[model samples]
Target: MTTTTDSPRWFKSSYSNNGGNCIEVAANIPGAVPVRDSKNPHGPALVFPADEWSSFVSAVRAGEFGNL
Candidate 1:
């Protein structure tokens, strides 16, 4: 079996405007989620375990971060 590492397909939320502080996330990668600054596509990306990323997203959706 041949395994290939695909490139990250980063995207920010539709609600995001031209704000330079935005972050982009790539959910396409299996087992991992890559996050990076939307303003710097070519910059380094931080990879997080899929489960952890999922939990973080869920918390955000549930407003656990409190108006972030």
Candidate 2:
């Protein structure tokens, strides 16, 4: 089995232009979602399971987290 590292290629969300404090995520990793701070590329990344990450996104889009 081979392990893939997602330390590179962090893509910012298209809706992050106005919010300078937003974070970015590098999607479609081998088995996890790689997320990192947009202002700090050299910083550490937080990896999340695909299912959990998707649920979080869905909640955010559906206003489950309240006002954006």
Evaluated with lDDT, which candidate comes out highest?
A: 1
Candidate 1: stretches off by over 4 Å? 1-6
Clashing pairs in 1: none
Candidate 2, residues 1-68: lDDT per residue as tens digits?
Answer: 44477344568888777566878787757758888887787788898998899999999999998997
Per-residue alpha-carbon lDDT of candidate 1 for residues 1-68, written as tens digits (9 for 90 to 100): 33223566778988788778899998788888888988888888889999999999999999999998
Model 2 compared with the native: what TM-score? 0.82
- What's the alpha carbon RMSD for model 2? 2.3
Model 1: lDDT to the true structure: 0.84
**Cα displacement (Å) at residue 59, model 1:** 0.5
lDDT scores for all predictions? 0.84, 0.79
| lDDT at 7, model 1 | 68
Off by over 4 Å in 2: 1-3
